[model samples]
Target: MSEKFQKCVEDFQCLNCGQEVSGNGFTDHCPNCLYSKHVDINPGDRANNCRGILKPINIAPKKSGYTIFYKCLSCDLEITNKTAEQDDITNFLITLKNQ
Candidate 1:
């Protein structure tokens, strides 16, 4: 069995807005605003403690940058991690730009 899927709900305080968020077994963003904190190196790992605000900014193609564009809301730092469903807009723009 996968430990991640078997894990129970966990609550985390939104570092961006000080809002307490409940992880509904599979949640990774603040439902109130869709903002995510840089808390884990991987989903549900809880290994990272950067506590930085992860904001969705831009998106690049799949092979070049690995995924979408991510900017740290707190320090304005830029990073590119894997993309999610919410990355549609950025992906579309990147696709157009590439063509």
Candidate 2:
């Protein structure tokens, strides 16, 4: 789906694990499992409309970025997100070991 940038609201329930999630303006993953659903093509923009379960598959440390890989649980959509502090979760360390 095409993307149109817009502001995002918080307190969304994770479509993957059915867990309640909140975005303090920076969070993008479920706190329980570190998984995210493909809700937008651009960050904070509700454009993709896929509503697919985006699983954390791998992690890559960039020279000036933090990468998190995701594969959708429904349509196999893939998405990558840069790390953010408000995105703290227990599964982050485990994801880093993948790559």
Candidate 3:
């Protein structure tokens, strides 16, 4: 049986940007880089074996906040995550545009 929303809170270093991330239970990505790891089959379950780096590609604005879109570097899997309070979406978009 697969579990959903396991609520695992752990600190991690970003593989892409080398940022030390402090996870708050719901943290699935780096606030500095908006990058995530493909570590869960379901939210917080950490059951996925891919272990891919999920790069932020785009964002969609919503009423509450924004939804971040990501694509896995290793497996090309696409996913979406809601923006965190500390996420630097503006800087990311600016850097993305400059690239």
Candidate 4:
């Protein structure tokens, strides 16, 4: 973890897909919808007040996993996050390609 990263484990419902998500101290985005909330300035810090919905815009493939790019709906802030192991990334990519 980065020095600024804090580990917080909390469950939340996915704002987009309404999936019940269980946090594993590193969970940020919803695995089902790949959408996250603008709640953290640093990972797990929850210091940001924008409270916007972070929509996954693009996916960058990596050797191990992928990096997900996002844009906040309310604040329009752009950010990137690593995909979790269980993330339904293929569906998102397919949806993106279709669009």
Give the residue spans of candidate 4 off by over 4 A. Answer: 1-7
The CA lDDT at 17 in model 3 is: 84
Instruction: Please rank every candidate by lDDT, starting with the best.
Output: 4, 3, 2, 1
TM-score of each: 0.47, 0.68, 0.87, 0.87
- Candidate 4 has what TM-score? 0.87
Kindly list the per-residue Cα lDDT of model 3 for residues 1-99, writing each as its tens digit.
754544589899998789999999888798887999998777778888788999999999998779989899999999888898888887688878998
Instruction: Write one digit per residue (lDDT tens) for candidate 4, span 1-99.
Output: 554434378788999989999998888789987999998888678888787999999999988789989999999989998998888887797889898
Give candidate 2's whole-model lDDT. Answer: 0.73
What would the per-residue lDDT of candidate 1 be over residues 1-99, giving only the tens digit for each residue?
533433346788766556687776555655443457665666666555476888756445675333545677766667555544432354345544676
Candidate 1: residue 83 lDDT (0-100): 43
Q: Give the winner by TM-score: 1 or 4.
A: 4
Winner on lDDT between 2 and 3 is: 3
Q: RMSD (Cα, Å) of candidate 3?
A: 3.5
What is every candidate's alpha-carbon RMSD to the true fold?
8.3, 4.5, 3.5, 5.1
- Clashing residue pairs in candidate 1 (N, C-alpha, C atoms within 3 angstroms): none
lDDT of each: 0.58, 0.73, 0.86, 0.87
lDDT (Cα) of model 1? 0.58
